[model samples]
Target chain A: MGIQLDFPAVLERWPSFLGGAALTLELAALATMFGALLGTLAAVGRGTHNALIAGACKVYVETIRNTPLLVQIFLVYFGLASLGLKFSAFTVAVAALTINVGAYTAEIMRAGFEAIPRGQIEAAEGLALSRVQIYWHIILLPAVERVYPALTSQFVLLMLASSVCSQISAEELTAIANYIQSDTYRAFETYIIVAVLYVILSLVMRAGFWGLGLVLFPRRRRLGTPL
Target chain B: MQQNTSSEPIVSLRDVQKSFGPLKVLDGVSFAVDRGEVLAIIGRSGSGKSTALRCIDRFEKVDGGEIMVCGHRVDRPDVDLRALRQDVGIVFQSYNLFPHLTIEQNITLAPCAVKKMATGQAKELARKVLAQVGLEEKLHAYPEQLSGGQQQRAAIARSLAMQPKVMLFDEVTSALDPELTGEVLKVIEQLAADGMTMVMVTHEMGFAKSIADRIVFMHRGKVHESGPASILTSPTTPELRQFVGTGNLKS
Candidate 1:
């Protein structure tokens, strides 16, 4: 027999897989919200007339984008340890993922911000909207609406990439799968099940994001075009 | 109208100069509009008429000279932009309504955010302005859903909601089709009839002649001719004659 199927062994250990998946989702959710906030701020910073703030934001985006996610996670995990700062792997994973996704989010958000017509900002300015008001109501909200699809995809990718947290023993889905596979001696079946779970998680994420998009961007929902 | 009675100018730009790198767009341009006067600036493309209107709103900072609108020194470095803008409203050729908001929301945004009006109070103001623009029914509709004329009207309503001391229209109807242009012009005419102080940069000679208390014709980045609306009928300057003649030829 070239190979044998033993999905039952993996399926019987559903509690561990379910817990791992739940933890993975929690990590993704935290990273997504925090990352989006950080990215949007960074994008705004990059657009500012102040050279120093803009330059710093540019450097942050470039450094993260240039480095591999695996290396970032390792650095975050071990760097904190080397500095004598004790932290759980889960905390490290979320921080690393947030930092990583924040960079990608910043780039996408910058594109969205750039796409806003100059007239809109001028109009807001003419209406006496303060700088912060203009940014919140006119620029940031519309920019996010414009790049929502890209943002959601980035989040889904972040969720999948969260699997890399297993290297730091983060006890997420992949880590649980590794434990289950070794215990049950059903490596092939365990991996296949985990893969299917991942696909299902991604599908659920897409559905959630699509719903969130409809709620967050009523204009887009009504017209099928970002405002 | 205030031009006929009041001596005070709500908007005054004196020797305002502006340039884009090496290109001088507005050279020593000066104009004033009284509390209820409708001053129309008309000229060919690249005549700096639009730039002058923008300077009154502080949308474009003058490279030199003075601009004072509604008691604010626009040319001064210490001038408060928000305060100056609150005293003036400017609408552009493109109806730059916030695409993400409904007509009502767009109208109410300034009043609520800038003026610090409560949401309910802002909504009432929105309803009133939308009614003024004859677009009360479109209160809930987003900008993209409206026609070009409707969007421009909504843009006007949005500005009107601010209740500025003066309003500036930068070729607001130039982007519309002939049929669509009529509706936007009608809204402006209605506002003028209500004695709203206004300055407009327009190419519509008939509309301008009918509504404008005074017309300033810019040629080669300077006010080549300035007088009553009758200037369109009897131009003292040959440049204005040629300008109006060509304008009539185009239409």
Candidate 2:
């Protein structure tokens, strides 16, 4: 007889698969929020006139972007443990993901910031707005509006990339697949199911980002115009 | 060329000089705008007209000399630039309306955040100012949704919401189409009739002759000729006469 597939055996552990999917989403959400904040700050830092601050931000962004995310996770996990800073694998996973996504976000935001016209800043100054007011009103808000589509797409990619967290035994979807496949002796079916779950998760994240963009920038929706 | 004796001048620039590397944009420029007076600055491109206006708001820092807006010395190292800005409202050639905000939000942002007015009060004030600019119907429209003239008016309303003591206009109508330019000019004319203190940088001689309390002709970063609008019609200097007589026609 030819080799037979044991698909039912994998389906029997549907609860475990579902739990893994949920954990993956949770990990992605936590990382995305913190990464966005980190990225915005880094973008601002890169744009600042201060030589030291701008240089440090540039170096940080380049270093994170050029290296592999897998290495970063391993470095964060083992490096922290070596220093006796023992954080949970989940916490380390989130940290590593945040660091990785933040660099990409910073570059996207910087491009957005650069797109703002010099005339606009001069106009705001002419109005006698305070520095914080200028930043929020003329600089940051409009820059975000201009690059919002790019930023949201990056976040969705970050969610998909969170699968790499399984390497560190984070108990997310892929990690759960590893556990279940070995237990049930059904490697191919288990991996295939996990891959489908990742695809579903990515779609959900993209939809959520699109919805958030609608709420945050109602003017674009009302006018049916590009920012 | 004497200062107005009726009221205190709200803005004064004395011997202000600004340079960009080798290019000198403003050289020994001096002018004053009295309270409730409309002063129109006219010059060809690169005549330092816009630079002189920017100096009053400290948007372009003066390399030499002093600028006083509402008695706050702008050139002084210790002066609060932001506070000076609060007193001087400026309108630009390109209406720099915040793209992300509705007209109402753009108008109310500074009043609520900078002035710390309550949100209700800010909205009410924005509505009143929008009405003043004939844009009450556009309170919810974003800048991208409006015509150029309407966008400029909203920008003017945004500045007016701050309740600045002096308003500076840098080629405010130059960016609009002829018909659209008329709409923006009409709002400015109303402001002049209402006795708002304003200094305008423009190439519109006809509008300036009709509305300006004083006409200043800038050439090569210095005041070439300055007097009443009647003087602009028959200027004394050859350069001023040539600018008003021919330049106005070509434009």
Candidate 3:
């Protein structure tokens, strides 16, 4: 007899699957916000004239980018535990995802910063703008607008990778799938549903980022030119 | 005709020396612009005309020299750059208007950020300066939307909103075609007619001859000759004669 599929058994745990998807999104959102901030700072710090600060920023970016995200999650999870620090699995997942995404973001943001023309900074200086004013108005804002697409894609990728948190039993979508599959003995159907949810999550994140980009860089929309 | 010999110069550079490693860009360059006077510096591409103009604004730190502008000593390390820039307005050939900002925003940026003017006040100032540049209609347009000449005019408007004591033009029309160059020069002529103290480094010898109070011919990183507008026609030095001979200066 042919093997029969049993999607109904997996579909019975829709509430658990819904809760898992919500947690996955929450983790991704928290990690993205913190990662963007960390990345922008590191990008600026790396471009600074101070050798020590720039060197430190460079080392952080290179080290995190070269290693696998799985290794980083393990290091943060086990390393913090060994250091006598206690935290929930969710916290550890968010922290590891943030750290992982921050490095990738720094590299992307550095390219954005590098793309700004030297003349723009010189013109700002000529206007007698203070250092802070120049950085915010002339350098950072336009640079971010120019690289908005690349940045949003990175965020989307981070959201998909958050599923790796399932290994630590962080109770995300994949972890929920693992539990439901074992209980119902419908492993294939459980994983297929989980994959669909992840895809939906990524599409939602992309739409959200695109909307944010439109608001943040309205000039690009108006002029059909990169800000 | 603009020789008012009694008043103090608003901008002065004496024995200014600048070197790029081994290449000496400016060697003992000295000049001065009296109040409301228009001094034009003319020379070939690498004659250090641009360097001398940049030094007055402290854009390039002079290796050795005394540079003063509007009573501020520019060559000294302790000189406040922000204050110096406040008193000086400069426009470049490329017209470096911020691409992200609108024309009004470009004009109002300095007055708003540096001078801390209110948004309403800055907008009013932008209106006035944009009008002066004959670009009142382009207040909401982006830099990329404007033609090269319009972009350059907007740059001048942006500088004028600062209300600087002196204006510096570094080949402001070198990037424009002849027809577009005329429109920009017209705005500058109006500025001169209004008695603004100005110094310009230009290849447009014709415009220099017509509007400049005096001209300094730079050659081989030094002042080859300095005299009134008549020098463009007379050309006492051989370098000036050769420079005038080139078709680029068709006065």
Candidate 4:
């Protein structure tokens, strides 16, 4: 017996797939921004002289990183409902994804922070810059620029992982793909198209990040240092 | 504490002591720099010259001694570091300019942030200092884009912009090549001729001989010998004679 391929049947459901892709992008965008802020703060917190804050950040990163993402999604979906805290599936998806990706971001950013040479901070101190100023201009921004590639990669993975939100009825790209395949009984074609859509989205996001990086770190661009 | 009188030394370290783990880096080290006086500290590697310089800026805490800089008690734990640093500017061997910022920003950052100087004032100050270092045209250039010589000059300009009472240079030209070192030395020489109160730790026997009002030789964490620049030509200590004896050096 021979198997035949049919992409048209899945392509016919373009509008539904487009809506799902848009929703997926929306979820990823929200999670990405919040995750970055939370992650950067967590990274700084982990490096503090305060024992309590550092320990707390350590525990947060460790617990979230070791556990599965699906469980985290389910916990936000059902556990919140059980506590009478009902939010739309979209909101729940965004929250869960932010919490999940934030841990990874913290680790990446911490490595970036640690990589900053001691001379940089010492130079800032010698200049008499305030503690806050040293952290912002000397430590955080340069560290972020140094680790920009790792950060962008983590964010792209976050966009792909938005697919898991489908399990919680978040109605993102993967959820829409499931509905289309079931309706037309064309599972293989549906997934193939979804995979291709994901690749395009990743490329688009990477391009956008590259442009932003150039604008954000003109020094790197002028020096011809690749992001 | 009483205010510092004009006749008083600008910086004084009285029997300052410092240790690193099991190693004692500074032992009963004592020295002082006066207004418009240039002091050069020369010693072999691991002689604690840099450590003693760092202590003047409170970069390293003295184990047991009194350090007075511009009337601030540096040995006290509660000393206002910002105020102390505002009066003392330090330049390091590695330039240490903020790579992410332009030269203009690097020079103006401390003044604008600490003194709350107006933007126009800081810009004028940056321009003036860059002019002083003969780097007036490289205002917008990043540190990495400049040559090592240019970068070192820019670092000196950055310290000058603070309008400090005293400047500390810790082997400022140690990391530069001969050509670059000459360029940076010229700037320092001009500063000394301008009568800026400064203490420098350096290994350039020639530069120290010509520019220093006094040269101090440190050996084994102690002041082995110290006096006028003429002392290099006629040493009173074997340690210093051996140090300057290595070559027929001249600036």
lDDT of each: 0.90, 0.87, 0.90, 0.91
Tell me the tens digit of each residue's lDDT in model 3 across B121-195.
999999999999999999999999999999999999999989888999999998999899999999999999999
lDDT of 1 by residue, B129-243 (tens): 8999899999999888899999999999999888888999999988899999999999999999999999999989999899999999998889989999999999998988988
Off by over 4 Å in 3: A1-3, B1-7
Model 4 interface RMSD, one decimal? 1.6
lDDT of 4 by residue, B165-238 (tens): 89999999999898989999999999998989999999899999999999989999999899999999999888
Query: What DockQ does candidate 2 score?
Result: 0.74
| Each candidate's interface RMSD | 0.8, 1.4, 0.9, 1.6
The digit string of per-residue lDDT tens for model 2 on B45-123 reads 9999988988888777788988887878888877887788788888988898888888998888888877889999999
Compute DockQ for each candidate against the true complex: 0.87, 0.74, 0.76, 0.58
Query: Candidate 3 lDDT, tens digit per residue, A68-160?
Result: 898999999999999999999999999999888998889888998898888888888889999889888988878888788899899999989
Residues A1-227 of candidate 1 have per-residue lDDT tens digits of 67768677679999998999999999999999999989989999999999999999999999999999999999999999999999999999999999999999999999999989999999999999988999999988788888888989999999999999999999799999999989999998988888988999999899999898788888877888645
**Model 4, C-alpha of B40: deviation from truth (Å):** 1.0
TM-score of candidate 4's chain B against its reference? 0.97
Error of 4 at B132 (Å): 0.5
